[model samples]
Target: MSIDTAPEPGRTHDVRSADTDPDAGAVAFRPAFRAALDATAAAGVRVHEPGTEAYRRLSGTFNITKAVRPLAVVEPTTPDEVATVLRLAAVHGVQVAVAGTGHGATEQMDDAVLVHTCAFDELVVHPHERWARIGAGVRWDAVLEACAPHGLAGLCGSSTDVGVVGFLTGGGVGPVVRSAGLSSDSVRAFDVVTGDGVVRRASATENPELFWGLRGGKGSLGIVTAVEIDLLPIAQVLGGAIWFDGADLPAVLRTWSQWSSLLPDEGTTSVAIMRLPDMSGVPPVLAGRTTLCVRFAWTGDPEVGEEMIRAIRCVAAPLVDLVGPLPYRQLGAVHADPSDPMPVHEASTLLAAFDLDAADELVALAGDASGTPLVMVEVRQLGGALRTGPDCAFAHRDAAYQLFSIGIMVPEVAQGVVAATSRVHDGLRPWSRAGGLPNFCDQAGAERVRRAYPRGVEDRLARAARRYDPAGVLLAGRGLRTAADAVG
Candidate 1:
C-alpha cells in the first residue's frame, strides 16, 4: 500500500494517498500516527506493528512469493471500525490495503496500514430465507459446513479454503459453474466501507451502481465487510474425478476436448494433467509422477449423469475412479486443491475453443516425457449458464474454455516453472483468447486489466472507482488505476 510515489507501470500498489494535490504536504507514519491507530483499537479493534507474531500472521498471504509487509495491520470487528481506519488514513495521508484470508493476495504492500478483516468472522444462516449472511473473514469451508445440515449449498470453487468475499468479488467460477452460473450471481447484498470513510449497503435496489461494480471489481471501490448470499437447495450432486496414467494423455486430451464441447448445461467439467509432489498430503499412487484427472459435476438425474460420464471413463483404464453421487458439502474433493499456504506462479488464458489441434499441441508441449516443470495444467469447460448471467461488471462471457497453469515456486525449479508455463501457453496460441478472468493469472498489472475486462466494462469500473473512492484512499486493487487515469 506504499503511496510515496505513483505506481510504476505494470506494478500493483495496494493503496494510493488521497493527498495527491502536489501541495497537500508529505506525510509519514510518525510516532503520533502510531499512537492514533493504537488509540482507535479501544473501539473493538487491534493494531499490530512489525516484528511481532500478530503482525506477521495478520500480514501473511497464501502465495508466499507475493507476501506483503505493511507498516501495521489492523483487525476491526465492525464496519464502523473499518470506516475509522479509512478516515484516519485519509486525514493522516497514509495508504490502506485490505486483506481477507490472504488467498487472493497479489503484491507487496511495502509500507502502509493493512486492514485485515480477520475480526469480522460472523456467519448467520437463515434457513427460512434460503440465504446466508457471512463476514469477509469467513471461508467457503465454514459456510459449506454450516449449511450442509439444512440441505443447502453455497457456490464455491474447488478450494473451499478461499475467503467468501474475495472469491465473490472476483467473479467466482466454481465446480458447478455451468449449472449454477458465476458465484457472484448469488450475492444478494453487501455491507462495505468506502474510501470516503462512509459505510454503505449495496444491492439490486440500493446503491445499484455500486452493486454492479462490486460484483467483479475486487477491492477497488470499497472494502467489503459482509455479504448476504442466496443459497441453492441442492443437497448432493453426481460428481468427482477419474484419473488416468499420463501415458494415456494424448487420447485423454483429445477425448476430453471433444466431449467437453458437447456437455450439457446440467453438467460442468474440467480436466487437469498433474505432476504431484511426494509429500505428506499426496497419495503414494499419485506422487512424483504425471497423471490425468477428469472432473465432472452433474446437477440433473444420477442415472443420466453416470451415462454421460461413461464416455470419459471408457477412454482408458483409470488409475483412480472416484466419480459418483456426492454430498454438495464435499465438493472440494473433485479438484483436490491444496489447502496449505505456499509460493506459486500461476498463468491463465481464455479460449475461443479447445478443438483437436489445441489438444494435440498441449500434449506435445507437456507430455509425460516432455520434461516440464509445471505442477499442474488445467482446462475448464466454460459457457452454458455462465454466459447468461445478469448485467454486472463480470466479463468474458463468450469464452468457450479456460486454460490455467500453476507452478510451485520451490527454489530449485522456480525459474524453470515460470518459463515452461509460458512455453506451453505460447505453443497453444492459435486457440487462445486475448483476455483472462480477474480471479486467475499470476501477476497484477495493466496487461491483466486489459485481459480481464473489455474497454466498455473497465470504463464502467473506472467510473465507479472514481465515484465511490473519490479521494483514492482505498486499495485500487485488480487494476483500478490502470482503467481510470484519475486514480493515483
Candidate 2:
C-alpha cells in the first residue's frame, strides 16, 4: 500500500549481548542479520547493540525498578523503519518490545529487540481542523505547548510529561476526564505498523476493527508510528487543588465524597490523602505531615465552577487553597504530579461504590494515624460523559469511582510500600470491582490482564492479537494470548 514518507531502520549495526536474564544466557547476532541492518536500503534506521555506552544510555527505562537489558535497541524515525524492525524480528523469530518513551514499561525484555520510539518526534498541528498529528515520541507537554497559542489542547492526563501514544492507547484518564471523557475517544486516526511488516492506517472508515481495538488496547495490535487526535477549543479552565490538614481526614474525606457524588459532569474531581516529604518544592505547611487534597477542573463558566468547588472548601479549613482560573496549558498544576522520574509502586481498582462508609474505610487504610507507608491514596469520581463516551476496548464505565495508591520505592520502605499497597486494596475489597484500567495495571501479566478485561474485551483483544501479531513479535500481543493457543 502507498503511504506517507516515513523511514527505514537499521542503516548501521553494532552487535553485542546484554544477557540481563540469567536463565536465558548469552544472545548472538548473525552475520546475515548484521548485513541486512548495514544495507544501504535500510538508510535511516539506527540500531544500538548491548554492551555499548550508547546502548546502555538508550536502554535505561524511566521506572528504575523494572529495568531490562535487551539484545538490541532500534531507534526508528518513521513508519517504514518500524516495519523493517518488526519484519526482521518475525523472520528471525526474535522477540520484540515496543518501548515508547518508556514511561509505561512493565516487562523485562529479555533477549528481545527493543524498539524505542524517541526519534518519532514529529508534531503537526492543524488548527483549523481542530486536530493534531503527533509521533509516538511526543509527550503531552509538547502538545500542550504547541496548541496553547491556538486555544486548543488534547485531553492529557495529570502529568504532561507522559508520552502521548502510550497514554491514549491505554485509554487516558485525565484531570478533566469526567468532563471530556477518555482521551482515546478523541483519536482521529493512527499510522501503525503491524507485526508482519504491514503498514496500515486505522480509523473509523479504514480498518475499523483495528481502530476500535487500538483505542484502549495498548499495543495489543501494533506499534503506532503517528496518531491524529481531536483537540478541544477553549483557553482556560477552573483548575487547581485545595489541601486540608490530615488530622481532619475522616470528616474531610467523607464530606468531599458526599459533595463530589452530586458533582455535575462539567466538573472533574479527585481527592488524595498525601504524606508529603519535607524536601525542596514541598510547601512548609504540608511538609512532613499528612494532608488531604481535592483537585478540581471545571470546563464550563468560571463562576459556576467556583460555586461547585465552594462546598469542599467549606468542609474544613484549608491549609492551602490554590483553586482558581488556570490556562489549559497549565492543567498539570491541578494534579501537581512530580516532574522527575522516581521508583514508584502503584495499584488501582474500580469501585462499585464510594459512599460515606467507603470513605471512612479509605481514611483508615491510608490516613494519618494508620501508620501506612503509602505516599498517596486517591479516589476519583467517575460518571457523566465517561459513562456516555464512545466505546472501544475500555470496560467498566458504570463504575462509580476509582481507587489508586502510590508508594515511593526507596530501599528502606520498598517492602513496606508493596505491602501497604496490597493492604489498601484488600481493605477496600468489598467496594471494589474485578478489572483494572489498562493504564493502571502496568505490570499485569497475561492471565491477570485476561481477568482485567471483562465483557469479552479480553477475548476480542486476544483475537486481534492473533490477527495482527501472529508471530508473537510484540510482547504485549503475546500478553493477551493464552498458553494453549500459541502463535508463530
Candidate 3:
C-alpha cells in the first residue's frame, strides 16, 4: 500500500505510503493535512495521521475486502468538531469520507480524510412522543435496548450491530418491513454537517431538499451527526427461521414463492439457500452442507401468524422450526445474520417477478448440487407499506422481490466466488430489473449509483448536492460524481 506519486488535479489518489515507510507519501500533502490535524487538535478533537496506530485501527471497515487506508482518520465528539474537520479538509483541498461502524464500505474512497463518528454515541428515547434521537455512531442493538422497557421498537435492519444513521440514510428494510416500511420513511429529522462547514437541521420544515436526499441518498449529500425517527408500539412479533435439508429446497422454494406473494401486510418473509462452512458457531445439520431456510416475521395476531406459518411448514418436514412469539428485542434472531466481521463480496438485484421459471434458474445456479461457491443466496418478499412512502430519493418501490448473494473472500475461492455470483446475476436477468436497494448496493462507481435511483431522481439528487456540497468534499455515493461533473 504505497502512494509513490502525487495525484493530478481533479483526480483521486491512494493515500497509503510504501511498505518500507508508511509516511513516505505524506511528503506530497503532509504539510496541509498535518496543519489541519494541528488545528483540530487545538480545538479538542482527536486526529490520527497515516503512520499512527490509531489511524490503522480506525481506518478498517467491516467489509475487509474494501478496507480504507485514508490519509487521516478524525474522531469528532461533537457536531461542531465534525464541521471543523470538514471545513479544514475543504480549505486544504483534501477529500472527505465518513464512517460509523464501517459496515457499508465500498472501497471507493482514496486520497481522503476519514471522519470516524464512533464518538457520537448518544441515544435519547422519548417514549411519550413515540420517537428517539440517535447519534450517528449508535448501533441498532443499543436502540433496541433503550426502547425495550417502553414497549417501543425502532425500524432496524437484520444485523443488530449495524449503525443506525447509516441504515436509515440508505432506506433500511428490516424483518417487519412490509408492515413498518423502510427506516428512512420513519425519520422525523436529521442533524448534519454539509461540506460548507455548517451544521443544519433537515426535516419536513427545515432544509427540506436536504431532508429528501438524506433519507435515501446516503452520505453523498452530507455527514449526518444525529437523526430523530419515529418508533413503533410493537412489543413483540412472531418471527424466526425455519430450516430444511437441502433435498427439500425445490419443494420448499416453490411453495414459499407462491405462499409469500399472497401474504398480507402483516406478513414479511424471505427464503435463503446457504452453504455454510463447518465452523464452531454453525449447527451441525447446516454446517458444510447446503440448507434451505425460510424466515418469517408477522406483526398481527398470534393465531393468524401461526396459521400462516403452517402453510410453508407442510411443504416439507423441516429440520428445525424456530418461529414463535418473541419480544422485539430478539428481532435479530429472525435473520440470524453473522455478527462477526469477515471479508465478503456481496451483490444484489431487484426482481419484478420470481415465477417457477425463475426458481428453476436459481436452483440450477445455487441449489445443493449447483456447486456454486456462494455462501448465501436470499430472496426477500417486498410490497405492502414499502410501496407507498413519503417522497424521498429511494427508488425501485415497485419491485416485488430483492435477491442477494454473498461469497466469502477466501484466497482459494475468491475468483470462483466472483464468477459464480456473476453467473447467478446473469441467470436471473430476465426476471430482474435495473435498480436495487441502496443499502445493498456494495459496488463502487457512478454506474452502480445510477441503479439505486429511479428516472430523474438522480438528477434531483445531483441538484441538491451542488447546493449543499459545492466543493464535493463529502463524497459518499455516485450521485456526488454526477453533481461534480454538472456543477464544477
lDDT of 3 by residue, 451-486 (tens): 787657887888887788878777674455664476
lDDT of 1: 0.84
Off by over 4 Å in 1: 1-44, 486-488
lDDT string for model 2 (1-488, tens) is 11111122432222222243232223434554444344313555677755555567667767777677776677877788888888877776777788766778787787477888888899999999999999998999999999999999899999999999999988888999888888899999999998777999999999888898898888878999899999999679998999999988899899888888899899999999999999999989999999999999999999999999988888889999999999999999999998766788988888988888898889888888999989899998888778877768877778888999989999999999999999999999999887878887866458556645774787777777788888888877766767316422
**Top TM-score: which candidate number?**
3
Please list the residue runs of candidate 3 whose C-alpha ends up more than 4 Å from where it truly belongs after superposition: 1-19, 23-30, 477-479
In angstroms, give how far residue 320 of model 3 lies from its true place.
Answer: 1.1
- Report the number of the highest-lDDT candidate: 3
lDDT of 1 by residue, 184-208 (tens): 9999999999878799999999999
lDDT scores in order = 0.84, 0.82, 0.86
TM-score per candidate, in order?
0.91, 0.91, 0.94
Which ten contiguous residues of candidate 2 have the minimum total lDDT? 1-10
In model 2, the runs with Cα more than 4 Å from the true position are 1-25, 29-44, 483-488
Model 1 residue 298 CA deviation in Å? 0.7
Model 3 quality (TM-score): 0.94
**Clashing residue pairs in candidate 2 (N, C-alpha, C atoms within 3 angstroms):** 7-81, 9-45, 10-45
RMSD of each: 6.7, 4.8, 4.8
